[model samples]
Target: MPRTSEPWRKPPKAWKHEPGRPAPGRTHEQTDRRHPIGTRAHEGLRQASQGTRTLRTGPPHPMSTPFETLTALRDEWQALQPLSAENEARLWKKLRLWWNYHSNHIEGNTLTYGETELLLLHDRTTGNHSHREYLEMKAHDVGIEHARTLAADKSRLLTEGDIRDLNKIILKEPFWKAAETADGQPTRKEIIPGQYKTTPNNVRLPQGDIFFFASVEDTPPRMAELAAWMRRELDSPTLHPVAFAAKLHHDFVRIHPFDDGNGRVARLLVNYVLLRSGYLPLIVRTEDKANYLTALRLADAGEIGALVEYFQSLAAQSLEWGIKAARGESIEEPSDVEKEVQIFVRGQKSGDPGPPPRTPTQVRELILHGVEPFFRILDQKLATLSPLFAETGKPDIASVAQKIGLLLRSTAASPDYRWEKRFDFFGYTGKADAPFDFSTTIQVAFEPADYRICCDGNVLKSLRYDEMLTKEQSEHLAASILKAAFER
Candidate 1:
């Protein structure tokens, strides 16, 4: 066939950049027939496709937000600086357990704490959780790990893509879920992982009012706005991490960007803000579901402080535990102690032997791991009395593990295995008024079956191998020591 003159140089008829033209491949008739939208509507679609519109970003934080109180806790947690390797492992491990348990729990997950522990920690699964719920919990845990990794990378800036990716990660694969339509008809909605919603969604309030999130057409621009705001604020952080986290979570939730997993991704984003800023994640425990929802409801009604304060309390509590972990104290919540014990008992009954107990072979490793954190916890307790004294010193720790030669003792393992751990805090309290120097020592000696806890050559109590020194005991011990130091 004969080609047209300079055929390569001439653009296609469709590619002509003429005003009032149809799209590249479409004829005017076809374009007009397919897109009956008017000029204004077409422009709206174009803007929606671009999603470049920035939202009106709000203040970084509520004006009434208090900083001095939160910062003191934050600073102390930070000052601890580079926690011991063992404590760091323990702290993160415990946090991981709680984070997984509670995040799912507030969403009406039926898995008990023990069940969640086994699934996440031991590579085992139990309980009557539906296959979907089980998979979701696992996927959410993976999302948390991914978020931690992402937050640790100081170089990457926040982006809408990351949030969508998180929604995909936690939601795992796309599937249909039961949802109500805009007209309140029950139906299954197709969820495309990592994709924005194609339909509008809303909630029915307790008082029968219809509450709404961002419209389907508005999600993209609003999400883009949130991501942009996050990036800019990270560069110049004016708000406290807690406040920032609250805002990030609330904003993401308001947009409801993804069809499914928006709530999970929102919480993930909150922790992302916290982790990047050297703070612990604020866990909304299952028990606090009512309060959490109430706070968010109030926030939706223009009372931002309610949500901010709710988060501030959680952040403050989180900081206290972080400091505790940094100082070698147990970060286990009160419920954690009971949960740990119950799980242990369940394991024993089932002969599973959960989380390897201190064995004879691993005695040194156990002692090294156990004593350092114990000393750190005890040191903080003693450190408080320093202001009343003239000078103070860092606590000293020592441990020796060997069978003690007892004159009369009978046991199945013939004295089995034993270890001694000691912590010493020494200082002078009275420079002129008292002019006295004192050394206070606490020791825990572990045998095969039980452990003896002592202070200054006196046995305080002997607890079974499973028991931990409770906070009550520690507080009483501190008070008694302070009293004796002054009286003596």
Candidate 2:
């Protein structure tokens, strides 16, 4: 077992170290028995992580590091100190669920955010999801739970054992799975929980190239070096927490230590770093995966600024959410959380070809009865607009009105849309259809004076304009509103 010969530098000025007098500096060769020589198997990592410069001392000062900019963010999170334990617990739970969902989803875990929560919180399962997905979700929850435990215990420093334990949690009981070879041959690979890679692995590049990891033979020593680097950085106190986490993630992926679950373990450890520093965990949304990968690629090229900045931004955002939750404010749940909750509770399948179940019969009846007369009147008035709609081939405004009216009628009657109880005023109910989410809401609200046509409750137009629309104009307006709402 070789050890790192690199000398330890002075701790960062901002961070506190032991109060005793400085000990005599010793050569790394004296410590080589404990720390081993970490071989750089991936040529790119040697260039990217270790610059070409030959240094007489340790790496550059914390001030010169790319993570220095994260100081303000870290300070902001700390200044909101003394948060109630209840608040911390609530925020932590919310973040854990979110982080678990996104991280697992990125790795192709089939459980939706809702299903993940249902399994974790309610001990319930909703869909006919695969057994592997359920186990994956369960394993992630265990890993996060362990991270939280470690984060709360200030005395526990991160160790190689901890890293392996996280990997073990992620892999759980391993089984045979399909894997690709260096040249892209499909093969069955056996995974050993908590163990390093037994075979070579390569990542597929967007441009049809392969990015190979450190050789399997080098994984053990590289992991030793990583543990040493982590301890050194954590003790230094100058490296911004986010940057430290980012660096750790980058180096771990560069090593690609395990045959599987390396990415998942890397991300979990990133949050582990943040949590240990008294900061909230960042949930890297699956939607930002492309940008996230871009940041990593940039870091792999020896340009770490992008990855650091990305981590800082995500950390700041997560801290804001934590603070809000701690203060008893209603933090917005992830869009997936609400959507998934609805799916399980309401039994509405995702991507269902059929319309969602209809709203209550009373609500449907109200919409149908109230919309019928106006539609009839509009149908009669559309005769004057024949010339304007000639190209439509429907011939006249009545035909256009009829077609559009039918859709609106059907949409309002569907169970998939919801009725805003607040807008119900005897005749019309404010109804909405959030196809996937609140990003796009097709709405119909009954106003005091006239009906409002809207998307997500933002009124686009009023059905009654000056109370004097020409017959043809009325027909066109009605048809246009219906088209916009249904098209969305």
Q: Identify the candidate with maximal lDDT.
A: 1
User: How do the residues 314-345 of candidate 1 rate in per-residue lDDT, one tens digit apiece?
Assistant: 77788888888888777776657766886777
Give each model's whole-structure lDDT: 0.64, 0.59
Off by over 4 Å in 2: 1-73, 79-81, 333-337, 340-344, 347-488
* Residue 329 in model 2: lDDT: 82
**What lDDT does candidate 1 reach at residue 426?**
43
Query: How close is every model to the real structure, measured as TM-score?
Result: 0.59, 0.59
Clashes of 2: 7
Q: Which residue pairs in candidate 2 have backbone atoms (N, alpha carbon, C) closer than 3 angstroms, thus clashing?
A: 2-36, 3-35, 3-36, 4-35, 357-415, 358-415, 441-456
Q: Which residue pairs of candidate 1 clash?
A: 389-429
Q: Which digits, one per residue and each the tens of the lDDT, describe model 2 over residues 36-119?
A: 221221211222233332211223422233222344555566777777888777777678788888898777775655567778
